[model samples]
Target: MRLFFKKRSTFKLFLKLTDWNNLLNSLTQNVIGIINSTKDSFTGDGVFENKERLGFLLKTAEEKEIKILDVGGVSTKPGFKEVRYEQELKRFNFFISNYFGKFKLSVDTMNYEIARHALENNFEIVNDVSGFNDLKMIQLIVEKAPKIILVHRHPNSSDIQEKMNYKDVVKEVRDHLEEKIENLISHGVDKSRISIDPGLGFGKSMEDSQKLFDNLEYFSFGFPLVVGYSKKKFAQNLEMTHEELYDHCIKSGVSLVRLHIAS
Candidate 1:
């Protein structure tokens, strides 16, 4: 696969491929396009409402040369309505079946069944926002040997909508990622095969989420760090435009920044 880079007036961007084994690396351009396949995305960019929107977003992603896509079937915003597994499967399956080989794919799911199906269908990354709290999810990752993104969700709540208090957001999130990384390593997964996500808005209050983002580099524990702050409420509250937020992420030296369709 060819990797395309956009030229900046100040500097020329560069990318390093991992022998075609994985599409992600620290040197990769810092944007991973997002595909919200559900009907109720907070960003109002869900393709379920208008199928034509998916085509438009795809065209935009192609124009931006976004090679890696992070697709989520259900919304993860606070107070999000729970979606049935079959409903999630329909949306995810449609995209996977039709665009399997067009771009590198990452399945954003907390369900073991969905993760398993995606891995079986050749998805390269499993982005479990629940931190792989489910043993079955970990087992599947071990069996499939696909790269995984372990996100920092508050352990006290199973639902992403529930907010949890944090004493020190940075240390707590860092500790959570560290523990998960150790667990994956102990299970025989290589260090390079795993990535960490700060999980910006899930289970976090707006203040806590902003604090976490401000200290994003603290969560980087010798592994690739992935951050998903695109279209988040906390980001908007800060009065920073989307371009400014993305620029902040790039300057933070993160491996990947999950982004939404450019509007």
Candidate 2:
């Protein structure tokens, strides 16, 4: 399988590959854009709940040639309200059909039913925030879509401040991901098709988050790294502005940075 990258004005075009394993091993920088589909997103850009606004955003992303668009219907931030499956499915389908149907789509969900539905609708990736706690969801991915992203998370924890306890932030996160990777491999998921995320603000405190970012090299884990630190509470309190944060992310060797600000 061969992958080609072309620059067309502001958009970048990524040609599909017949062999996904080879493509994943290739050293290439890919930019993934996130669409905040919930009103309670930590980022202030929750106004995108409007379909028209979402359409415009999608058009702009296509024009810019983003490699992937991750649509997240549920907000996993601290103190987030529990969103029902019905509501999530409604938003999920709407965003997929209206904005992401023609592009490479990734659904940000931990529910088995939701992930299965998204995969059935041609979504190429799954962003599981629960770190594959749902055995059924893991089985579905292994049996159906072998390529999926497994994020590290502290199960049964909701508050960010409470989940920051770690003997060694970098080592613990890496080991946790390695364990998950081995589990997936044992279950028949291809190692080349897997991606790992450190989950910066998911359940970490400001200090732990800083340590994770500082020790990013230690947690490379032989897979693509995705760091999502856009507009998080830690950034909001920092002396730097959003633009500065974006520049910081770019310099941090983060393969993909999920941002809420307009690019």
Best by lDDT: 1
> TM-score: which candidate is best?
1
Cα lDDT tens digits, model 2, 76-151, are 7777777899998877776766664456677888788998898888888888888887789878887785457778
C-alpha lDDT of all candidate models, in order: 0.75, 0.68
Q: Clashing pairs in model 1?
A: none
TM-scores for the candidates:
0.87, 0.81
* Model 1 bad stretches (over 4 Å): 1-22, 25-28
Off by over 4 Å in 2: 1-29, 47-49, 155-162, 237-253, 261-263
Write the residue-wise lDDT of candidate 1 on 108-132 in tens digits: 9989999888888878899988788
Predicted candidate 1, C-alpha RMSD: 4.4
lDDT of 1 at 241: 62
